[model samples]
Target: MIRFENVTKVYDPNARPALDAVNLEIDRGEFTFLVGASGSGKSTFLRLILKEDRATSGSVYVAGQNVANISSWRVPKLRRGIGVVFQDFRLLPQKNVFANVAFAMQVIGKSRSIIRETVPEVLKTVGLEGKERRMPHELSGGEQQRVAIARAVVNRPGILLADEPTGNLDPITSMGIMGVLDKINQNGTTVVMATHDDDIVNEMRKRVVELRNGVVVRDEARALYTSMIPVVGESRRMKDASDAEIDRAQGVQQ
Candidate 1:
């Protein structure tokens, strides 16, 4: 439900583009991984999808609407259908787990009855059913992240954008978080995650879109983190469309 057509993003007129002529399409009910090194345009890709920034050139479409053309007043409406989880949990320190998740629906004007039902349901989904009253500091890192995930999905968003959701946790904890994300995808929310965790990527073997120097070098479907490929941030952009064609021919699914 997300498409980018020849998209380029340049923050400064004189500098190189953060994203250069990137073309991508993420279908509904699919989970994709945006894998790249720092400054490889992974975050920029996610931001464009979120409408946090506009592409310098080209179009960004989410859920069938061109994000560049959408009105600012409708940005919130657009975001309401999407959930976001970050590397940092970003939980409200002063609020308990239940209040943190409930706040998401409350801000959208959900009824108390709805909030009461959804908060607990989402917490349970994230495996935090009995820890509702715990403060942020009282929970472990993984638990805190679970609360953040619950908050993001409490509204039942159709798309979930996770930017390094497991970056700060241990391997075991990260696996737990990944399982939660997989479960969410199984429930039909399109999941696009940006990460550098090779173990996680290789283990999950999901669709991987590898970026290097702000360009897409590989888009491998149901692929492992193949060490045979160029290392992250070290791969140069394909010489031409033919290069990408070769990658696709090698079973790199869209």
Candidate 2:
């Protein structure tokens, strides 16, 4: 489970806060979407959850552990339990699909035997079973994103955070990715995604949390990301790539 209680963040020492008094609870096995205009603290919220950035003030708990108070030595282990996918696919330029996914396992010190056996298995889960030898440049954008997903979940993480996961793909490809995420959630991983894709958000019909000016204005058990999404600053890059042009665009990352 992930819980944020009265969480707040202020990036600049002399600037205004980025996130203000956000409170939320995401139960295990549930799929949820975080919606907001750009600069509404959506990215900041994800960073806080991933511990990439600490809250200037407030409490955060993941899997019953307080993230705000976790030891520096334990941060990595905590991240291992949470997988994250960015807007841009972060595959290694020189690595093939197999190597990219196996990379995660190798990082936590998994034995070579397990790495050899487990990599292929996870690839199969994402429907990339036989393309292990293919490089990222050779795969479709959607396919490359799938490889990224495989890498993230290779650790069997209990929580998954995807920020604008489908922003770079077409509607059909977006659905494919969502299907995989839903499947993961079904298998008991908590999913928290930040996105502005109206169709996918509305179609999934999961929990929805909306933010405006860095504060949550709405929270619903079953909400759809529609025209109602808050429109904030540079965050309006929602239409960055249409499905037709997505394949031509390179992946982006945080």
lDDT: which candidate is best?
Answer: 1
Cα error, residue 26 of model 1, in Å, equals 0.3
Score each candidate by Cα lDDT: 0.90, 0.86
Pairs with backbone N, CA or C atoms under 3 Å apart (clashes), candidate 1: none
Worst-scoring 10-residue span by lDDT in model 2: 235-244
* Residues 167-215 of candidate 1: C-alpha lDDT, one tens digit per residue: 9999999999999999999999999999989999999989999887688
- Which segments of candidate 1 are over 4 A away from where they belong? 227-254
Query: What's the CA error at residue 140 for candidate 1, in Å?
Result: 0.6
Which run of 10 residues does model 1 get worst, by summed lDDT?
233-242
Show model 2 residue runs off by greater than 4 Å: 227-254
